[model samples]
Target: MAEEFRLRSVAAVAYGPATLFGLAEGAILPVIALSAIDRGATTAIAALVGALIGIGSLVTNIPAGVLATRVGERRSMLLAAAVTVAGLVICLVQAGSGPWALVLYGAGVLLIGMASSVYSLARQTYLTEMVPPHMRARALSTLGGTMRVGLFAGPFAGAGAMHLWGLPGAYCVGLVAIAAAAVLVYRAPELELTAEHRAAAASITTRDMIKRRWRTYVTLGSGVLLLSAIRQARQTVIPLWAAHLGLSPTTSSIIYGVAGAIDALTFYPAGKVMDRYGRRWVAVPSTIVLGASFVLMPLTGGAVSLALAGMVMGFGNGIGSGIVMTLGADVSPAIGRPTHIGIWNELADIGTGIGPVILSAVTALAGLGPGIIVSGVVGFGAAATLWTYIPRSGALRQARAECHD
Candidate 1:
C-alpha cells in the first residue's frame, strides 16, 4: 500500500554513499598502493595504510550504529554523508609522506568505514521497517541483488575514473557520489514507528537488547565472519598473485567483475529458495560450496582457472546473501533494529576488512598457495560450525506451503 518496492529502492539510493565507499576501496586500493609505490613509500608502509583502515572500522562501526538508533535512520544517513565528505576533503588536501599522510589517510579510511556502516545499517533497518513480513525475504533479496550490482559496478567505475583523471579525479568522483546520496536521503521518507516499535524502543535497555538477541547476533556474526574471510582472501590476494604470474591488471579486474556479476544475477533465485525452503537450508550448503571454490582456487593457473573459481564463489554467495540479512532483521530486537544490525554489520566489516590483511600476511610468510589453501580450510571449518548449530528454515517453508495448498 505504501509502494513498498519503490521506497526500498529509494532507501537503497540513500545507501549509495556507503556503496560508493565500498567501491572506492575496491577500485582505489590497487591504485592507492600504486600511488604509494610511485611516491617511494615502502611495502611496509603500503601494508600499514591498509591495516589502519581495518582497525579504524573495527573500532567505530558499533558506535556508529548505536548513534544511528538514537538519532533516527534518516539523521544517521545524513551524518554518514557529512562524515564521509569531510574525510574525502582531508585526503584531497593532505600532503607529505611519513606521519602526515598516514594520519590523514588513516583517519579518512576510518571515517569511510564508520560512515559506510551507518548508511548500511540505516538502509537495512529502514527497508525492513517498510516491508511486510511475508514480503521481507523477497524484498531483501532484491535489495541484496542491487547491492551486488552496485558493488560490482563501483570498482570498475573507480578504476575508469582513476585511469582518466588519476587519484584526485577518482576522489572527486567519490565525493560527488556521496553528495548525490545525501540528496536522495533528504528526499526519502522517514520510517513510521509502529506502536510495537515505539513500545520496544521505550522499554529496551542496551544491555537488555544484547541479551534478547544473543543467539541471533552470535550466529549471524560468525557466519558473516567466515564468509568475509573466504571472500576477501580471493578479492585481495589472488589478484596480486595473478599479477605476479604475469596476468595484467585489466585481466584480473575482468575476472573479479565477472564473479560479482554472476553473484548479482543469481541473488533473486537464491531469495526464492530461502522464501520457499528456509534461510538455513540455503545458507549452509552455499557456505560449503563457497569454501570449496576457494579451496579449488590455487589448484589452477591463468585467467581461465581464476574465472572458474570466481563463478563458483559467485554462485555460492548468490544463494544466501539477501536471506542472511533478512534473517538478521527477523531476529533483531524490535526496539533497536538499527543498533543490532549495525553490530552484526560491524562484525561483517571486521571479517571483510581484516581478511585481506591477514591473508596477505600469511602469503608473505608462507607463500600464496599455502595461504589460500588454509583460507579454504578455515572457511570449510566455519561451514561445519554453521551446520551443527543453526536451525533449518524448512519447517517454516513447509508450513507456508501447506497453507497455500
Candidate 2:
C-alpha cells in the first residue's frame, strides 16, 4: 500500500537534489550583494542588484509552472541548472564599472533567481507525482527538511571557501553545488504517468483547471499567503527587535541560530501529525503559536527574553514545515498540477516578498514594536483564515481522514 511505503525509499531521488540545490542557493545569498559591491556598485545599488534574484523568482513562478508542465519536472531542473551555471560563469568573469557591468550583474542574478523558481516548482511537482496522498505530508516535509538542513549548513561551506579565494570562491562553491545537483537529477528516473494521469492531462486545459477551482484559489489561497507572510516575518522581526534593544550583532546571531536549531527539529513530527490527523490539527495551533510568539518578541527586554521569543517563534514555524506545500498538494488536481501549484507557490512567494516590506514600513511610521505586532496580527489573521477554511477547502483530505478513522 502507499501508506506502507517507507520515507527512506526516495531519499536519493527527492532529498539529495533538493539539499544540493538549497545549499547552492543558501551559499550564494550572503555573497550576491557583496559581489555587487565588489563589482564597483555603491551600497544602495548593490542592495538593489541583490534584490533582482528575488524579483526574478517572483515574476517567473507561474511561467515556471508552464515550463514544468510542458517539459516535465526533471528536464525543467536540468534547464534551470544550466541557467545557473551560465549565471555563475558571468558572475565569475564579468568585471568593471558602468551600465554594462550593472546590466551583466543584474542579468546574472536574475537568471539565477528565475532558475530557482523552476527548480522549486519542479521538485514539488516531482514529489507530488511520486508520493501518494496518505504519506505525502511526510514525503514533502522530509523534502523541506532536507532543503532546510542544506540551507542551514551552506553558509559554513561558502565561508570556508571564501577565506582562501575571496568573493569568487563563494561563487565557485555555488557553481559546484548546482553542477552536482544537476548530475544527480540527470541520473534519476523520469516521472511515469499512469493511464489515469494521462487521461486527466488530455482532458483539462490549465485555464479550465483554474476555472474549476477559482474560488479556492482566491479564498483558500489567501490563508496560505498569510501563512507565508508570517513565516517570512521571522527573518526581520527577531533581528530588528534585538537591535532595538541594543543587542550586538554577534548576540543576535546566536539567538537567531538557537531559534533556527529549534525550527529545524520540527518537520517530521509536523508532517506525521498532519498526515495522521488532518492539516487543521497542526495548522490552526501552529498559526496561533507563531502569531503569539511574534506578539511576544517586542516585550522581551534583554537577550535572554529575546532568545525565548525567538525559540517560540522557531517552534511555531518548525511545526508547520510543509503546511503550505501540503495544502497545495491537497488541493491540486492530477491534471494541470504544475499550473495549480505554480499559482499556489506564486501566492506564497508574493507574501514572502511583501512581508518584510510591510513590517519595515510600519516600523518606520508607527514604531518598531508596532510593526512586529502587525505581523502578529497577520498571523492571527492567518490562523482565523485557516481555521475557517481548511475544512471546507480540503474536504477531500477531510473525507480521507474520516475514512482512516
Candidate 3:
C-alpha cells in the first residue's frame, strides 16, 4: 500500500509546480521593499508595500480555498499562475516612473498575493488528500524544502538579473518561473478525489465547518499566527537591518540567499523529529531559536555578525518548514478540510501582514534594534503558548491533567 502511494509521482507532478513558483516568488520577494525604497518610498511605506502581499493573502484565502474545491487543485493553480503573470506584467510596466509608480507597484503586489494564496491553498489541500497520515509530515516537509531550494537559488538568480537588467528584470524572472509552473501544472497527471472526500464536500459549507470548529481553530490558529508573524518579521527585519547597517544591495541579497540555503538544510530532519517525537520537538526549538536570533541581531556590529544572526534564524526556520501546514492538517476535519485550511492560512497571513507594520512602526519610534527585540519577545511568548497548549498526545494530555490534579 505504501509503495502504491507513489510519492515520487506526486513529487514530480504536483510539487514540480511548487518548485517553480517558489523560485519565482523568492526572486521577487527580497527585492519588493528595495524596489519601493528606490522609488522614494520611506522605510515604513516600503515595508507596507512588502506587507501588501500578506494583506492580499489574508483577503483571498477563504475564496481561494472555495475556488480550489469547486474547480480542482490543478485548475486553481493554473488560474493562480495566470493571474500572477498578469500582476508581474503590471509591476514591470509601472517600474520606475511617475508619482504613482509606488502605488501601481503595490497594486501589482496585491494581485500577486491573491494569486499566491490560491496556489498555496490548492497545493496544501491536494497534498493533505494524497499522502497517508504516518508520512504526512515528511511529505509536506519535502514540499516545503523543495520551495526552499527555489528560494535558495532565487536570490543569486535575482542578483544576476538585477545586474543585467535592474529591478524590473527581477520581476521578469518571477514572471518566467511562474509561467513555467503553469505549463508544468497543465501537463501534470490528474489527482482524483475518493468517494469519501466527495461525500464530505457535499455535507458541509466552509462557513458551517468554521462555526463547528471555532475552538480548535482559535487555539491552534493563534499559534499559527505567531509562527507566521515571527517568520515574516524575520524576512522584513533582516533586510531592514542590513539597510540600517548600510550594507550594499548586492551584499544584502547574498546574506539573505545564504540564509535561505541554511534554512533549506533541515526540513527532512525536522519532519523526522516531528513524526517520531511530536510537534513540540520542532516547534519549541524553532521559536526559541528565532527569538534568540532577533534579540541578538541588534547587538551585532558588522555585516558578518548580521549574516551569522541571519543564518541562525534561518536554521530555526528551516526546521519548521511545513510545521504550521502540518499542524493544520492534523487538526482539520475531513469534511471541508480546504476551507479549514484556508481559515488557518488567513490567520497566518494576518500575522504576516501585521509583522511588517509592527516592525516598521517600532523602528520609526524606537530604533531598528528595539523593533527586532520586540519580535524576539513575541517569539518567546509564542513558544510558551505552544508548549502549554499543544498536547504531546492523547496520553500526554491525560498525564498532564493528572499531574495538575
The candidate maximizing TM-score is 2
Give the distance in Å from residue 335's predicted Cα in candidate 2 to where it truly belongs. Answer: 1.1
- Tell me which of candidates 1 and 3 scores higher on lDDT: 3
* Model 2 per-residue lDDT tens digits across residues 351-370: 88878888988988999999
- What tens-digit string does per-residue lDDT give for candidate 1 at 272-373? 666666666777777788778877877768789888887888888777667556767665655566667767776677678766766767788998877777
Q: Point out the higher-scoring one by lDDT: 2 or 3.
A: 2
True-structure lDDT of candidate 1: 0.68
Backbone clash count for every predicted candidate, in the order shown: 0, 0, 0
Ranking by lDDT: 2, 3, 1
Q: Write down the TM-score for model 3.
A: 0.87
Candidate 3 least-lDDT 10 residues: 394-403
How big is the positional error of residue 295 in model 1, measured in Å on the Cα after superposition?
1.7
Off by over 4 Å in 1: 1-27, 34-40, 194-205, 240-246, 353-367, 394-405
lDDT of candidate 2 at residue 394, scale 0 to 100: 60
The positional error of residue 151 in candidate 2, measured at the CA in angstroms, is 0.9
**Candidate closer to the true structure by TM-score (higher is better), 1 or 3:** 3
